[model samples]
Target: MGKTLALVVFAAALLSAQAPAKKTTAETPEARAARIHKQAIVVDTHIDTTMMLGRDGWDFMVRHQPESGENHVDLPRMREGGLDAAFFSIYMPGTVTGPEAVKRALILIDHVRRLTEQHPNEIALATTAAEVRAANKAGRIAALMGMEGGHMIDDSLAVLREYQRLGVRYLTLSHSVNTNWSDSSGDKPAHNGLTDFGKDVVRELNRLGVMVDISHVSDKTFWDAIETSKAPLVASHSSMRAISGHPRNMTDDMVRALGGKGGVVMINYSVGFLSNERYEAQQKNVPSAELPRVSWEKIVDHIDHAVKLVGPTHVGLGSDFDGTTVPDGMEDVSKLPKITAALLAKGYSEQDVKNILGENILRLLEQVEGVGRQLRAAASKSD
Candidate 1:
């Protein structure tokens, strides 16, 4: 019996020595953050890289850090950030009008397409939710397009339809100024909301499967859009006005209304949108370098507020990269994992994080496309 016990003891010690250390339940926030960021389908619904491509001759193929150059997004940074998908904005300033605007819009669209074409192995143009998933599965970034203003369509549904045909998926009804059909938050209220034509624009967008983005629209216009859209709405890049009190940010009521309709509000990383103090400082001509850097915590605060008001299903990231000045820690796209880490640190569940990262937008896209397919089928049958 003593010899048998000795043999068992010897065997137990040998096994203990051979066994790998058991992973602890407590994972370092950084390690956990990296895992979540990598596993999630991180999609930014609004990026102005298309404009950068058109103006700066920025090379999308090479990674450009913010410190090294003016570029905020590029292929390498996206990969480093674990950004699975992004919608490059075909943004025309509100001041540009007439055929020149349309020409510029077309040029930006062509630029985005050319970038994807040139970097076929690195990025793929995704027109549908399935395509986005496929791109992610194949380890390629899904590149999608969104028109930043309805003015680019030039008061014509035909131009809008043509943009849809050319793979423009979402249209922000206005930019910093009011369009003919829709009032902008940054401009004096003209129609008090969407004009008669604006309602029609929403309907046409619903039929075409293009998302109606209300980021820059006036509050009245936001309600008009909520009442008008058949499909779920998307605030392509806006934060909580209740948090920052900025006109560009959505009010609590607006956030709830959007969430009620099964839409998602992609939180913008713009310092102006994320913090009222920073915004006011900037308005007062405080040198950007003199201004206090907006913390990652503030960004998380916006996300938390939105989630509290609308639940996690309605919140997502929209960074607004290459379009606006980003916050301190999140200087560029490559620092995106910091968001996941911050969210995790706040005790957000993995599933909720997944939804917020990309799944919510993907589900909304699929539903919007499904509606479009049904409309097309019905029209064909009538014909």
Candidate 2:
């Protein structure tokens, strides 16, 4: 009895001496990393945040408190999710033509500037990749601008150059409409792709150090831009066609070519881009759960494909929050940690994840800037 009691006492003592494993503190490196990613320079290259800015009943910076709603982005939500940067789209509709379209573009650009001016401490305007980093370091949301449709420039290189001067860093050569020079992927094969002027836009963008976003351009236009630009291009918000055969998606060949060119294909988080079932269900207006997820697994699959094509540096995230309905797993900007965890599970090192999260985009932007600088120098020498 005495020996048994002694053994029991010893066991009790051992248990007491060992402290229970505590939950990881939010302040821990892992927690901080998750938090930083949520808060870090998470950039969504395409968001229709400016769409609501022109409307009377909408406010962009307020945290959306209502649980049931269709809106995907808001300032409070961004704060909660740690969203540090985003490209507010001056997205124009194709219906407006000529001078009217240019006017609308200006209105949208003004609205974006107003939003930034109103939220000076919380947000700041950023034109270059360097500005994005500087703005983030200063603990402010970097509100970069991009013109979604080339038509917004009114078919004038002067207008396009003006938009660039107004802090626009990238221009989507086509936006579901065929421009005088470039054809859109949304339209059936026309113009056989980009015309000479379309190629000029690419050249000018490269010379100006402005990024050429191939999203929404025709496959031919996409390839043409790739061949024409002196700087690495980006498909700002697109997905791999191997997973979902949407015409809007980049084909395996395109993905491979983009990787080969050292360009980054930032994964689009739209459900339609993630899975075939989801794309079909979305087309059929089916509810979400019934639709397949571009699960963290599927996202990894795209990243894996990118790795096979481009060797990892060419893949990045471009969650189209506020622009379109994203996948369920990526419902909001806040759920980015799940992506990090999923990436880790897929054997992506911390460095690789970091690159995917934002580094690649930064590097590509810098390349564009470098090209712009060289062009300016050459122009000056010629003068």
Candidate 3:
């Protein structure tokens, strides 16, 4: 009986050894997202970080929680969130005009440039798509500049040229109000779309390699600018109107047109733009006291809708951080990874996620730059 038992044990051991080891269970969605997020070159095209810096005298090198301070972005949080690049906005309120507008834009621009100069090892100012990649490879956050309103130019193409010379790569045609040349979504229509001068501004922006941003423009202005622009456009910080039903959000037709033109619509995280229900609830309250809660899932729904309207190549994250109240889970810039996880859970392919994260904007930047070079060469030949 002992011999028989020994033989059975040996047989069992041999069978176990011969059998292939059981494969490990598939990685959890969260784990998959984290891995993918780390590998991707995430970029936020619109952030009002400079506005906060100018207001609170906050240190860009130090990380501060939103509850502790009004600031939402800093070096440590960016690193923690794996954000590779960001466009620090030079935002001049629509009310500020004439020399005052120009002065405010200059001050904000200087502040952003100073941040990069102060943190050479952590961040570098990038003017081109290649420079952004280089900054990423160097393990630094690529800093880019975007002017939030065309009013900053004050009807002077010379001022626009100076802005480009100062490293402003994108210009949102209007802010919360209409400018002399362009109409804003937030204000009463003035130009009805874009004045002839508005079309001139688009041409000059294309020639100078500056992206024409239509985020705050009226529907007529959005269509007009895209039609006039020689290069791809960028709705730097807007969401889907189909979902949120806000004027601040782009309609499905606008998104489709933008995609056809090779432009991108970077979804905004502002609670008002993420959901109409939440926005209406907040507006109904006296003094806008309490806001209806919105989740990260709602933000993802906007992204998914944009992808469906226009392929994944025309969608990206703008965050609008520090400029507005974000959704519940996305209280600050550090919560960006949650977006990646959410997109993956929603069945987006790895490539689609990468495009939505940063690749799409990079391609747009390259194409815009190429058009600028061609226009410049033609002008020089004519001269």
Candidate 4:
């Protein structure tokens, strides 16, 4: 009996030793998203926190909570969000115009530049796509600027040129109201899109390598500018009208046309832009504190819509941070990694997500710069 028991124990030990090792499980969606998001070069083309620089109790170095009413786009949250570059929107109210507009614009520009200067170790001002890439390689954030309203140019080509010299990259043709030249979507048509001078402005922007933004322009002006400009355009912070039904959002036709030109539509995160219901409620004097928050999924819906219409290469995140009310779970920039995960869950490949994150805008920048060089060379030849 003792010999039989010993034989059985030996057989069991042998069987255990011969068993194959356990198979490893495939990567989870969250894990894959985290890895891809970390490796990707993330860029948000617009944020409106430059005007908040130097305000009481607001510091870009410290991470802020949304409840504090402090502005977004701080260095800590930017790093947390894996954001490599962003275009700081230097915005003045649509009412501010003429020389006063120019003054406010300069002040805001100086504020952002000074902040970058003060944090050279953490961030650098990037004027070109190459500079943005270099800044990413150096493990620092790239800070770029865009003038939010055409009025900032003060109706002077000289002012526009000076702004370009000052490193202003894209010009949003109008704000809430029509500029002296270009008409706005928020107000009644004035010049019926772009005037003769408006077309000239688009040409100059092309020559200067400044991207023409159609975020607030009327449909006629948008069509006019798209036709007038030699390079691709950027709707820096707009959403899909089909889903949200906001007048400010772009129509499906607009996305198709813009994508045909190789342009991108960086989806906006403002609740107003994402949901017509919320916008109408807010407009009806409903207190925001009592209103339900807009879901973050709406951003992905818009992104998916644009991607399906124009492919993934023509989509990106604009956020419009610090400029308006963002959707839920996106109260701060640090939650940006969620965007990557959401896109993955929606069936976007890693490469597609990468393109939507930053590559598309970088390509747009390069194309804009290329168009400028070509136009300048042709002009020199004519001279």
Candidate 5:
């Protein structure tokens, strides 16, 4: 009888332990968001905060912790968003060209270097995949530079190499303006595509292990880049034109091609990149050419579309915050969690979401670095 009683007690104890515990409160939306966000490796590809640092005379670190104004990114906001890293654009304005544009690029590059020098603890200047990992381990944001226009080098491969040595990892090849070797999507008459020199630029970038970014190139130029580049390339801040119909956006074919090459198409969070209607709406109010371009919720929709088209591997985030106008809900970098929640609702797997947030970018970075290593080995053998 005593043995029977003890067995009953043991069973009772096991049952009690197995019972579902009651929550102190229901899992709040905020709490769930925090949990999911912590599991992701968030990356914003194209934040233009450097432009603010240069043009607006804004500080990047704590010395001037300005409120989140029209500006969409700050160091604190990045921490809040759990952003792993970002490509801080050293975007040269298209209006200035030749010597003036090169001079401007040099000055901006200096500004980026100074900012990194000033905030060693808060940010690290990354030029390779290894540096990105080291920066993440150091608990600081990995700040990498991407030259937004090929014009910045003034058609000089030597100048391009100089920028690369100075830590510029990717070159957009063109902004809104056509270069001596390539026509932009924004350029009229199209020039058919990349010139012979443009092809040389592609080869040179591959040789140097620098990424070829196709954000503002014409469709012909886009295909040419894909064909010429031995290494994978990225559209650091582009959206699906199938949804928005913007020439500045990538078509479904382009996204698929990028995926086929094992590259990433980071969705730009510009409202204009999201929907044709939103773009037309803004165009009416603002001049055709101006700063502070705005984006909206449809931005998430475009991201969703890219993922759907190319599965998850091809898509990632490039918010274009501070560099261009962002959408309404994503007013600042801290609001990145909202995108996470939206992505979750759309039924993306946690691994896929994490890849879209940052992993794919890391993969592309590694690929570029590998190409760089190979080129050097070949050159050494020749020597």
Candidate 6:
């Protein structure tokens, strides 16, 4: 009887081992990522879709594919990517300056404003952080404008004021070439950083409630902007130099200093900015099509490095979409969900992820606006 009982027990154990395992009831990484991403107010601080406007007559209403030429962010892809807001850049090449720069900037702003009005159901023009939240709440993507070069302002405070009135929220001090007042990373150091007039520009922007974007500026200019600006500055579309070793990318010390002062560095999605090897290929005059692709995971790596250096509050997204080549797998705005998913896998908490996505920049905007209010009030009193 004992041997028979033992045989029966052994048979049951064998059956239990052979049976399929029960599925877990816990939430999956993908599902959790989606949930958190959907719940977050996603904002991309830089995109060059406006540049595509003059060239190919880019329409915000149309859904553009990844394979399309320099057409990255659009309304449909933004919705698919859960992007609640984006800053459409008013771009002008370094060669295009003076009246032409001013004219082009005005035209681009007009285009974005008109497009937003034309697609009222899908988009809303936003200037303030409050307006951005309101637009997202109403289930519409917020269309924000940023000037890509200080030269576009025509060296006039009145023009800058008009730009602010027309909803230009940030002004990148320089582009690939140095402006009269500010030095650019891509050019020979002309002003040695920022001229006296450049510092004045920073001050005026603070008074006008426009963010001072230090993306393409030289290291000296970056430091000067940080020092002169009353409000916290933004590196609208820059990555980390420690990771990619590009001069266009910020150093770890720059990141730390920027974060220490309440400023944020929005990571650019350019593969060359995220990977040194790819950047080397770019320097060798390799064509964009032939430029070796970097893993999209490098995007998250940049975010991770920034977060680790300055905590999540100082890091945000500023995909240089339509302006530069991105890493593989992040073909267009549609693939942004992968970033949130990867962050989750890297053990970022939901709130941290949300902060990095948009909240941090929103907070920065609100603070900048508050400072503007104070400055204006003081000016009124002085008068």
What TM-score would every model get versus the actual structure?
A: 0.92, 0.87, 0.93, 0.93, 0.88, 0.92
Model 2 residue 111 lDDT?
A: 91
Expressed as tens digits, the lDDT of each residue in 231-335 for candidate 5 is 999999999898878899998999999989988999988777776876776667866565344445677788888887888887889888876656666777777
Worst 10 residues of 1 by lDDT: 54-63
Lowest summed-lDDT stretch of 10 residues in model 5?
Answer: 61-70
lDDT of 4 by residue, 344-374 (tens): 9988899999999999999999999999999
C-alpha lDDT of candidate 1 relative to the true structure = 0.91
Query: Which digits, one per residue and each the tens of the lDDT, describe model 1 over residues 270-372?
Result: 9999999988887899986798678867888999999999999999989899898888778888988888887887899988998999999998899889888
What stretches of model 4 exceed 4 Å from their correct place? 1-25
**What TM-score does prediction 2 earn?**
0.87
Candidate 4 backbone overlaps, count: 0
TM-score of candidate 1 to 2 decimals? 0.92
Model 4: how far residue 44 lies from native, Å: 0.7
lDDT of 1 at 197: 94
lDDT of 3: 0.92
Clashes of 6: 0
Superposed model 5: Cα runs more than 4 Å off: 1-29, 55-57, 63-70, 282-295
Candidate 6 on 1-383: residue-level lDDT in tens? 99999999999999999999998899988889999999999999999898666656667778977885647888888989999999999997977888888888899998899888788988999999999999999999999999998988888888999999999999999999999999999999988999999999999999988999999999999999888988998999999999888899999999998998899999999888999999898789998778777989999999999999999999999999988877779899999989999998888889999999999999999999999999999999999
Clashing pairs in 5: 271-295, 293-325, 295-326, 295-327, 296-327
Better of 3 and 6 by TM-score: 3
